[model samples]
Target: MLSNLIRQGIKPTPLIVCAGGTSSRCAADGLWTVDLRARHRQLIINEEREEVEVGTGLTMAEVLQGLQPRGRSIPVGLSTIPGCGFVLTGGIGPLTRSQGLALDHIVGLCGVWGNGNIFDLSAPTNPASPGTASKNETHQQWKGLLGAAPFLAVVTAIRLRTQKLTPLVIWRSVCSVQQLEIAIEAAETWEHSASLQWAWNDNIELFITCCADDPAAMEAMQSLRTHLGYCPESSMAIVAGQHAQPAFGTMARAADPQERIHSEVISRLGPAWGQRLPSLMADLKELMNNRPHAGCQISAQQLGGASAQIPVSRTSFIHRNAIWKPWINATWMACDAKGQESALAWLMRANNLLSDYCPGVHLAQIHPHLSCHHQELNDAFKNWLPGLKHLKSHLDPYGLLPPL
Candidate 1:
């Protein structure tokens, strides 16, 4: 179908490869949209290998449901609304500190390149497994696709490595700015089994979830509590054998869902950013107070542990050493053009204040309008850009896919 479109000299305004229209990346005025909603919905479980082959059309919720019965789970981002694009771009989730990014767990992928050529990239089923491509070539391609597939192709399916399902204990508490700072500092040295996310919406709240079965995880949770000087007003919940989906869901429910929202996101990566949390929080508070829209906010996610252990050279994801991903966003009703402009201006001001502390940005949260597209490509892939560009030329000579 892609070939037919290209052959007929038809260019889709933006080829959005998602089943649901939940992604903010979708082009509002695209001339054509190739929906992958019903294209690949298969789920094949390889119980022996503890891996699952899933169609790109499947939502994270569906994938989780499939894995639930098998006593396995995959690390995923905060929202269950994503599909292949999540893994294609760097899947940072609540369990990322322990299991690593979803991209890190991928064992194989099948996709249609921009030029409409079918390509299958997979790890050897076994050490003795035979393959046409040389080991070096396969390794290079694997690294490339781990983070750059979105700019190169439309993924049809993916085979991801899964871990045994485990119980999680989640703690939620409202904190003062000073207490939040202390919590952020403690999170920097948290164990792999523990992760933290705190948000400022009217009042500041910290959400900490840990793998209950791990003694070290429990200890780390205690350490965080001690650092924050826990208050009696805090609330906590313990799930026997479940992911942090419920916690994420609760946060989502708190937000008012608008049918149309115009927003700009700026994500910065660096360990120094964590050190400057207090000042960052101050800036966020000011922004929120003067927000042009009601839902405009700033948030951050902790990144480190096993994710930091993965070297940049090992994959196209260049921000492996980045310990925190702090993002600022401004959202207003899409129909309110004037409000959107004001919100965007406010977002830029907030971004400028924090830009100096951030040395890099995450690809998933990139916006072409706020930052230079080419510069973003350089920052994201760094030295890997040349090789990626070369591959892009070979696979997408017409540049049908989104520009990196």
Candidate 2:
């Protein structure tokens, strides 16, 4: 692909081959199987320390399972089925409120750069060498890893910390849109008192998931449920390997059993911009003026426990303090190109609600509405540009790496 694109007068760039995409619905089609070895060293899995040195090609779910026996877990985005390890782009789940972003636990990486030279980046001991290896500094290094792409290197192996497993408290409710707004306001207020995770759709429905090590969390959940005035189906425990139910139950009979059409923008908010988010549904209400493009929704997963403590600069993922990582999505099962395009376009427009609020990284699905700056190879990453370029120059000065 690189040779052909270059022959057609396009620029050749470094490309990191990844395997096992977790977010099939949200990524460029296809996969690349890459080596998982750490240069000439043997891979390590320190279950005693709740950490593992893994191949970048492994799926998020795979990584979780790898640590499951140890009763340890990592914060990951919603879809864990995708094969590659691009969790830093945007990850949210039941464990997010406690554990932080998936990339937060990364402690080390070994990969081939554009120059074809394999390099390892761990936490830095000194501020000057931001690429050094250390336990806590891994998250900072991971943040630098994004956007630089294959220029820095193909991430072959990643070392990340894990956490102990805890119980999950999930609640489901169906309400009118007006009721949903009231529920959202109540949920947001309760977020401080209860530390809850919640989502809602344009159809005026809500789903809230809460987690804690104590019974107080349950009490808080009860308060929110009472305030919302809806009897929720309770005790929906969210554990690893089990499929999660849709935040809002079956939409239409025409909807695919697996295809849950809910809007992330309405229910879940991204890391940095949730508090004062300008609602997309509010805008759509004005634009369509009573017309519904099948409606959009927002859902959320809380990040808590060890996640809240992870530093922003620690990993490529910077959204550590975010209350909830909102997933702004719509579901459709159309296979025709035209249907695909329409669904994609609608999702893009819904996502654009955040364009002015926060910049996002591509993970489960590539953002088609991503601005030209975001699409530019370098803009994909911030702050780590120089190091990546230096690696590229050293590894592929001849520019043999594939272009974006």
TM-score of each: 0.89, 0.69
Q: Which whole-number lDDT from 0 to 100 does residue 28 have in model 2?
A: 31
- Best by the lDDT measure: 1
Clashes within 3 Å, all models in order: 0, 60
* lDDT for each candidate structure: 0.73, 0.48
Q: What's the residue-level lDDT of 167 in candidate 1?
A: 78
* Model 2 per-residue lDDT tens digits across residues 275-353: 4434644664443332233443444444445555765444444444445444555544545455445555665665565
Q: Give residue 270's lDDT in candidate 1 (0 to 100).
A: 70
- Relative to the true structure, candidate 1 has a C-alpha RMSD (angstroms) of 3.3
- lDDT score of residue 176 within candidate 1: 76
Instruction: Give the number of the best model, judged by TM-score.
Output: 1
